[model samples]
Target chain A: SQQGEEDPQALSIQEGENATMNCSYKTSINNLQWYRQNSGRGLVHLILIRSNEREKHSGRLRVTLDTSKKSSSLLITASRAADTASYFCATDPFTDKLIFGTGTRLQVFP
Target chain B: EAGVAQSPRYKIIEKRQSVAFWCNPISGHATLYWYQQILGQGPKLLIQFQNNGVVDDSQLPKDRFSAERLKGVDSTLKIQPAKLEDSAVYLCASSLDIGAVAGANVLTFGAGSRLTVL
Candidate 1:
């Protein structure tokens, strides 16, 4: 079963705008990682945030983790058409297995 | 360094037929994992290997699915009598293990092999 659940199943925005996706998990985790997948392709790891960290940034990506609420969010600023893809959150909860969320489909129109 | 490699980007086979996919992880990676991802869903772990030994296969269907990672580098996953529900992408991932330390768990995944059961 999937331990993480992403909200805003689908989102659409114009190019140069910002997009935000949220994920919630059921258990404590050692880390939460985000990935992006193009259509019919493999996933690309974006960023990873440790449980003790509250926020981290990578270029245009910003991720926030709140262990108390068991939730996390990924923000993509200055979105572009090429940024259209599915974003997934993977939770590593004291196990080797990474439980992934359903994912958020973001479409950035140029 | 080269990323994880997988063969036969796509495969289409009839039901009840057998199919196999091969994967070679990046050099020096001691941990390997196989995951099955269905369309519109997240990937699920099928099995995991630490070196040449099985670390986890709790989710694998022993009846028709089997995997081997001999020599602790390359691995293969085989499915016999494939079912309609087995049509999905098989992803291989690997991570480095440094001296039995439990902190090195980040995984680098391959492009994956897509299977279509007819």
Candidate 2:
């Protein structure tokens, strides 16, 4: 079963703008990770944050985790048309298995 | 290293028919996973394999869906009597031993099998 839920089912923005996606999960988690999927393609690993970590950054992506609230957010700075895709948040609930959320679809127009 | 590989990029069959999907994980990877993704929804794990043994099959529909990893290298997922609701993309993924290490659980996904059940 899916454990995470993402807010803002869809988002539209212009290239060079910033985009943010949020995810919320029920129950405690061992860690949280984000993934991206292009149209008709498999998912790609974006980043992961352990339960003890609060914030992490990679390239133009920033992920913040608040275990107290069982929530996490992904920020994409300077978005691009190429960045247009669906983003998903997955949770590892100590079972060593990742359960994904509904996902957020981001559309960036050039 | 080569990434995970899946067969039959797409398939179309009527309800009650049978279909099978194959997956070959990256060389030496000890973990394999299968997920089902309906349109506009996130991928849901159907089963997971650690080596040639089953780790989790709680979400799998055992009545119609089954999977196996014989040599701990390649795996197959089969639906004996497909249902219309089973029309979705079946994704295969692989990763290192998840429990053996904390940072080795990042998954590498395959291109996925697009199954259309009419």
* Model 1 ranges with Cα > 4 A deviation: B98-104
TM-score of every candidate: 0.96, 0.98
DockQ of predictions, in order shown: 0.59, 0.78
State the TM-score for model 1.
0.96
Q: In candidate 2, which residue ranges exceed 4 Å CA deviation?
A: none
Per-residue lDDT of model 2, residues B4-95, tens digit only:
89999999999999999999999988999999999999999999999999999999999999999999999999998999999999999999
Q: Alpha-carbon error at B72 in model 2, in Å?
A: 0.7
* Cand. 2 Cα-lDDT: 0.95
TM-score (0 to 1) of chain B for each candidate: 0.95, 0.96
Candidate topping DockQ: 2
